[model samples]
Target: MDTAENRLNPPSQLLLALEVRGILELQAFFAAYPLLRYAPRGDGHPVLVLPGLGASDISTRPLRTYLKAQGYAAHGWKLGPNHGPRDGVEAGIDSRLADLAGRYGRKVSLIGWSLGGVFAREAARRAPELVRQVITLGSPFANEPKASNAWRLYEILSGRKVDDWPGREAMKLPPPVPSTAIYTRTDGIVAWQGCREQYSPTTQNIEVEGSHSGLGHNPAALYAIADRLALPEDDWSPFDRSGLRSMLYPDPLRSDTDSEAALRVSLAV
Candidate 1:
């Protein structure tokens, strides 16, 4: 998904304004929210969480804690703050994926935020056999990688300019396993358009009403994560938003309605 082109960048100023919700995202952790109060328990699988650019595991602690409480063996990437795929960082992640799968003797699930989402997709692409599924929170891995509001800052922190890498093209499709892209219309870091997954049998796009930063803590998002992880290993299905949950989550498959064409244009870009 990392490419040299800047053909479709989002309104940088708008992204900046939307980023302010990052503060509210932090507040969710301190609030006495009723969301996710009874999210279904998981099958006690091992889940690996990755933070966004410039953030470390500390940023993911709240999400990881929730996952743990839901009976998942959640682990944060502790190899220091995310600064992009610097020299050994990518290798380390691959090794980590391999080790986790081998040790647990089961496929691993990965959840990543922003740039970390990009990392999660690539890892699955390389080793689908070891990966059960991937869930990305506001990751811009489908289209223009340099389109993020933080691309410039990513360059500064990563010590490398934005550029294409191996398997970037393959990212246009779902990784060799079940893939879910959890995005919002108001994402301030990267264009929400670029975060949508192409309509595919094994890929899905889940829409939530929260800032990109708050996605990890958003009640709707947490419940969706629980719903996804609860799926039987061999009977995967698209998100079910038939009843009251429909009010919480927009119809992700509502492409035949008014929002269809615009949504298509956005993801197609």
Candidate 2:
């Protein structure tokens, strides 16, 4: 059963104000960031992007475009809308992975947003050998039914219970190969704790400062993603205090508290 604390935290008025301002600031930053104009790494491993619930491929186009410019082969799930669980969904994902593997001659990296992250993790569990890494943005993996603010709305729209995770109980996550779960404490859509994966040797959780909706577009988030992907296959390391500080306080020219306060305001909203 979902506890009261497990549900989404209501946004405060201040949070709403900050989010509006943050949105503008974030957009400007993305526009100015020259690094995002090109791929961070030139190696050509395929990256599959799965959009959040109710989001289409178009929603992920900015990141996709940046990735393409950087020289990575990025693709979105060509299957129609991302409504949770319909018939043969698992098989369809498997087929997609197989096809990409055959064409690329390498395991594919998956970057999933929101519920799409859950799907990516499940796919990796099914075919570890075919997945190079898994990254999820603002995903809810630890909670049961009604834990997320969208639970009721999602059920109403899709007519399916998403909390049911058959075969998920016994399934151990594939040995972590550069897996990164990026989430924000200020997420308005899902409980922040739900975004946490139980600590494991292979899995690492990164806390970012942004709203749930802005994660995919946040400049800081994108920089982190690019940095992670750019790491050599053997160089993957758990996010340490040094790395976190560097990411959170990348610019000596700007005040870190501005971003930190913005994150707090977003959560309050």
Query: Which candidate ranks first by TM-score, i.e. highest?
Result: 1
lDDT of 2: 0.70
Candidate 1 C-alpha lDDT tens digits along 1-269 = 33446366663564457567777866765573445757778888888898998999998888888888888888887779999888988898888888888888888899999888889988898888888889999888875756677888888887776764556677667788898899887676777777888877888889987687788887778888888887777777898877988897887666524333444476479
Clashing pairs in 2: 11-269, 12-268, 12-269, 15-265, 38-70, 39-70
In model 2, what lDDT does residue 180 have? Answer: 80
Superposing all C-alpha atoms, what RMSD in Å does each candidate have to the true structure? 5.1, 5.0
User: Any runs in candidate 2 off by more than 4 Å, and if so which?
Assistant: 1-26, 37-39, 167-176, 239-269
- Model 1, residue pairs in steric clash: none
Q: Residue-wise lDDT of candidate 2 within 128-231, one digit each (tens)?
A: 89988888888776655555667766776467775565755443343345578888765667765566666666777777766777777777677667766776
